[model samples]
Target: MTKKKKIKISELPNFDIVDYLKTDKDIAQYLTVVLEDGDPALFVAAIGDIARAKGMSEISKKSGVTRESLYRALKVEARPRFETVTKVIHALGMKLSVHA
Candidate 1:
C-alpha cells in the first residue's frame, strides 16, 4: 500500500492576481464569447470576471473610484461615461473601439 502526504493550508502560497490572469486567458476570451452570445446575464458575468482579472480592488484604489461604481460601469446595458470607460480600459490594459 502507498501512503499519501498531507499538505497544510498555511503552506499554500499566496495568490498572485497578475500571474493568474496571464496564465488564464479565459477571462478575456470568455468576455468575448459572451459578447458574441449577446446574452445580458452572461455579458454581466464576463464583465465581472474581467474586472477581477484586472485586479479591480487595486484599480479602484489607484483610480480613486469605488468598487461599486466600477461594477455598475461594467454591468450589462451600462452606458458608462467616457471617462469611466477610459479609466477601466486603461486599468485593464485594454483599448476601446467602435464599428460601423
Candidate 2:
C-alpha cells in the first residue's frame, strides 16, 4: 500500500481578501452589496477592507487621517464621525449617494 501524504491547512497558500478587491468595479459591487444589506458597521468594515486593498498609508494620506485613527474608525463596532467617514469614503474613490 502506498502511504498517503497530507498538507496542513496552514501550509496551504493564504487567501487575501484584498487580492479579490483589486478593481474599481469589484470594489464598487462589493460595497453596493454590503450597502444594500443596511448594516452601518458592516459598511464601515467594508471601507476598512477597501482601505487595506488600496494601501492603508495612501488612504491615510489621502483621507487626512492618521493610520492609527483610520484603523480605529474602520474597526468593527466603531462609530466614526461623519467627517471621518466621508474622508474615508472619498479616500477609497467612493462617495455616498441617495436616490429618490
**Cα-based TM-score, every candidate:** 0.52, 0.83
lDDT of each: 0.66, 0.91
Residue by residue across 1-100, what tens digits does model 2's lDDT show? 9998898998999886678997999999999999999999988898999999999999999999999999999977999998998998998888889999
lDDT by residue (4-76, candidate 1, tens digit) is: 8899999999874334455336556655677789776655555556777767898787666789998887766
**Model 1 vs truth, CA RMSD:** 6.7
**Between which residue pairs do clashes occur in model 2?**
none
For TM-score, the strongest prediction is 2
**How accurate locally is residue 67 in candidate 1, as Cα lDDT from 0 to 100?**
95
Residue 56 in candidate 1, Cα distance off native in Å: 2.1
Clash count, predicted structure 2: 0
